[model samples]
Target: MSLTKAQIVENIQNETGLTKIKATDTVETLLEIIKSSLADGENVLVSGFGKFCVKAKQQRKGRNPATGEEMMLDERRVVTFKCSGKLREKIN
Candidate 1:
């Protein structure tokens, strides 16, 4: 099953013995930091988990399957994650 934000907060609280409020704040802060770093074109790495990075995709052509109409896909940035081998092993 996929873990939600609430579950992540709960896990942090349990593991760190922090109050729910503190745990929530810490998690939010960490997410904001990661977002800001990626916005600045930098990567964020959590050693035992994975690395987060922004990847750029080039403009491309595409078609609408339903309408059979051609369209152009604009270039854009996307967030990507590469899981650490240790974490992948544990999950599997």
Candidate 2:
């Protein structure tokens, strides 16, 4: 199962002895900063964690699975993530 934000807040509280409210606030703030940075088309690199990059895609053709209809998708930007070498080694 995936870990939820509440679990993260609990972990932070357990590890750092911070109140639940404080932990939640900290986690939310960090996430907001990361999101804003990515929306601004800036990469975010946390030394031991990973790098988050924004990638741009050209307009493309796509098919709707249910209807089997072809469609043209608008150009868009997406976020990509790459694990740091240290993180990859640690996980393995």
Candidate 3:
């Protein structure tokens, strides 16, 4: 099962003795910072965690699976994550 934001906030509240509101605010602020950084095309690196990068993709040709029709996909930026070696080792 995947962990949700509420679970994270609850865990933080339990572990740190913080109130629900404070824990939720902390999580929200942290997420906002990460989102803004990525939107600005700046990579965010957290030691012992991972790195979040903004990657750019050029316009490309794509096909619609439903109709098998060829279409052009517009260029866009995407966020990618690379876990730290320590995190990868721990997961393994």
Evaluated with TM-score, which candidate comes out highest?
Answer: 3
Write the residue-wise lDDT of candidate 3 on 27-63 in tens digits: 9999999999999999999999999999999999999
Candidate no. 1 TM-score: 0.89
TM-score of every model versus the real structure: 0.89, 0.96, 0.98
Superior by TM-score: candidate 2 or candidate 3 = 3
lDDT of 1 at 17: 100
What are the runs in model 2 whose C-alpha is more than 4 Å off? none
* TM-score-sorted candidate list, best first: 3, 2, 1
Clash pairs detected, candidate 2: none
| Cα-based lDDT for every prediction | 0.96, 0.98, 0.98
- Count the clashes in each prediction: 0, 0, 0
User: What tens-digit string does per-residue lDDT give for candidate 1 at 8-92?
Assistant: 9999999999999999999999989999999998989999999998999999999999999999999999999999999999999
Per-residue lDDT for 51 in model 3? 99
Candidate 1 structure lDDT: 0.96
